[model samples]
Target: MGLEEEIQELEDEIADTPYNKSTEAHIGRLKSKLAEKKEKLEQQQSGSGGGGGYGVEKHGDATVALVGFPSVGKSTLLNALTNAESETGSYEFTTLDVYPGMLKHKGANIQILDVPGLIEGAAGGRGGGKEVLSVVRTADLIVFMVSVFEIDQYDRLREELYKNKIRLDTEPPRVNIRKKAKDGLTVNSSVDLDLDEETVKSVLREHGYVNADVTIGEQVDLDRLIDGVMDNREYVPSIVAVNKADLIEPDYLPTVESELEERDIDPEEAIFISAEEEKGLDGLTERIWDELGLIRIYMDKPGRGVDYEEPLILREGDTVDDACRKLGGSFDERFRFARVTGPSAKHDEQQVGRDHELADEDVLRIVARK
Candidate 1:
């Protein structure tokens, strides 16, 4: 039988089987097997030269992939946010290539990519989905665009990305494994876990772990455990942007908000905008800035005042060392100490070393060795 057929059979069995303590291990094995088959199939397709993958060169401070179903205002949103003139229409699949656009906000150049709208079976290489998803995997953040009236498309779009091995808005499972020549499998967990040791062993064995040491730091479900075992998944942060807000009346706002609530998305958290009319776009840009976690650091160059006009941009949690690296050349290697006067510093002009963490709008002066 073909690998796809085998995958289908496994999926059918897993779905048809009843779940309980008695069958938990059995289900785990089935899931592990299913994941392996899917991986193999994907590898096979890639080796056969499936379709063309969009050549998306990451630009600016960070790259954001705008994704959703066709004709869901993704192109419109891209045009509204950046200078890219993505062809927009009232029909599906208007964007056949990955359109690149730059969104400059708060002294940072953020690249926004308008990818082709995803379909139901896109993850399975349908309609050249593997190529599109490949580009998305390279992005730092995902901007999910959906029509205000078709908020349900959010779930479908997310599912397609999930099936393509993209884990949105979630961190990777903290499951560490060490392979051993012998002595059988050993499982250790720091916290109480739902899946017992035997079930964990069963899943690991299915993934070809004959003798290994497994350490799990958190209580993980079956899917997470499988994710931990596999290394092909991409974990990305995503935000929902409901487009076509201008078309909806104020009275109908509550209805749309309720639909967002049904999808477990906080209505207040989701950005409602009219990409066509360019309404609520400021809020959307703010969301992108916040999500990207980009921070601005004003450099205090010698004989030069703080360059606040053209401040250096970095990600959150960046340290003095990272700032120096961004500065490039001799700044990192010849740096002796840095003085910071901002939110990250304890006091104004506090002298710090390379390990000092920087905050947004921090005035930084680096003193290097002569």
Candidate 2:
């Protein structure tokens, strides 16, 4: 009958079916069909255009979204970390719109978004969840904020993002496909595959691939295979911040630490902060910088010394060519060579080319053509 009912039926069947070698192909086909149904339903829903999306324009070197349930101190955290005066309140849904702030850390301007708190049924488009989740999909990183009193909210937050097709902290599966004419579906893999070729073909056919050459580089389960076939997912890195640490009693610290461990997040690694008191903001900023994989490169401008006070920010593993491209204008077209002196260089002021990989705090001098 209806697409929603059809999707639920497919989901129920896949869940009810047993998993084994004999039933693997069946389950895979069911999963493919379910994914197709979900995709179609999502398209229909998007076309209906119910919610008013946020007017959040990505800015600065990178953007991070503050995601959590209501009254998790996201606004307080945003105010403490950046210049944005986000309204902080003790009640739920305090932030009705997306408030953007800029944090100047390590010579990088990082854009921080304090959006409305994500409720439990966000993936189902409840409470303007679709609009909020849409803003999050564009962020470079997601800072999962939860109160020390509500550490369990972390799982629900991640689950909402997952249902919205926002995959965190993982690379896209290396599944490549090339369409052909009249040769039929063929699957190839260097590693041993868990799914039989039939299952792969079923997924391809569900996505309307009749004759194609498919290559899967690694072993993937049904979900990963589906993700590979569907290219609309967003892969992002995330950091967990347990806010309002000052409210927790000393005796309950171990219990708090235990909860984080249960979530597979090291208590030491997770940033524990009292956002209202401005405590642990330093640690949070440091984690943001590290997780963003940013590095500072001091440019050696001619007729002037190296500018270390305002170093150019670049992502790690970036090369001299990348630096040139970032500089924009004539730097890219008139480039000749470059000299580097710092962590990335073999020696001080070593002559380097466009392919030279720059490290943090590297002093770079581009010898462009006159």
Candidate 3:
């Protein structure tokens, strides 16, 4: 049985154990520790190397994963982004094994994994499902793939996550646009035209929000109007690639563009691409890296007579205070200040307190009097 199952079994046995007043208090503490350990085990099992074969491979420093449904250009995109020489085919299940590739971006090496395809009933071992599902559960971020041709694809993806009880905290992808006039504007990729109250009302009518006074600067109650239209999943900050854009006619592009705008989806966030043809792949790669929000920092060795490198190596979080706390009470008590260099530091001097947030590519020199 898995560690999780074993933990659950132990919990059941412990609950049934005869407990006096004194033993009851100790039982609670033991249960809490058991719960914490179980959570950590689950986290490890989800990632490759933690327990499953889905551990994050270290490239230079950064880690990334390419995730999506089968035949959604996931492997193709991975090959393009990393040049990993992974086998790519048109057929389903071409990539049975997970493939790891190194992608260099912004002077940082990012390890990208092309995970196996997922289908319906995956969580329950349908089509060798549990394997791929477990692999994805470990990913820091998922590159959710969808074809532009599939109507209501976004909604379907959400339903699948719901079925598995996988809660995703994705921030809604949106763009801020300032309107010159109070009247609503019809947003297009190339041109922005005035969409008066009448046009807004008409669009609302089509969505069944009839007789609704749709006006600019007025709060449009999203729930009262449309059901299951807006994606409630916390936006994972993604760049939308409208794949197979070339398949549709030129004239239809405007209509698709307008529809996306009506939904408040940013046109800039949407990239027109043909993954098969490698068209617009460069732009897509740039967008993905930008949205990932990663920074790489290099550490330098401290000079002799005042060596602090040993204790600083234990630091994990991107902050001076975090580094101090990791050194235990000795460093914390003797902690005078921290001399931070690189991006986050304001000056080339010792920083005052612990609240200073460290940035990527920062070289820090912590100060403590003996």
**Which lDDT values do the candidates have, in the order given?**
0.91, 0.89, 0.55
TM-score of each: 0.97, 0.97, 0.54
**CA lDDT, candidate 1, residue 211:** 88
List ranges where model 3 is wrong by over 4 Å: 1-62, 170-239, 246-249, 258-264, 298-317, 321-337, 350-355, 360-363, 366-370
The best-first sequence of candidates by lDDT reads 1, 2, 3
Q: Could you tell which candidate, 1 or 2, scores higher by TM-score?
A: 1
Tell me the deviation in Å of residue 57 in model 2: 0.8
Models, CA RMSD each: 1.3, 1.4, 18.0
Tens digits of per-residue lDDT for model 3 on 1-370? 8776777776886677676554443444344444444545645645643334444344444445565566777678778778586777777778876777777666656667787656655543445455655555555455555566652455555455533434455432232233343443432222231323333333333333433232233222222111122222222333456676668888787777766575455666677787778888788767656656554444443564333232233213456676666546777777777776766777765465777777655666667787
Comparison by TM-score, 1 against 3, better one: 1
Please tell me which model should have the higher lDDT, number 1 or number 3.
Answer: 1
Better of 2 and 3 by TM-score: 2
Candidate 3 local accuracy as lDDT? 0.55
Candidate 2 lDDT tens digits, 77-117: 89988999999887778888889999999889999999785
Assess candidate 1 and give its lDDT: 0.91
How would you encode candidate 1's per-residue C-alpha lDDT over 39-120 as one tens digit per residue?
9999998888646556778889999999988898888888888988889999878888889999999989999989884674
List runs of model 1 lying over 4 Å from the truth: 50-53
RMSD of 1: 1.3
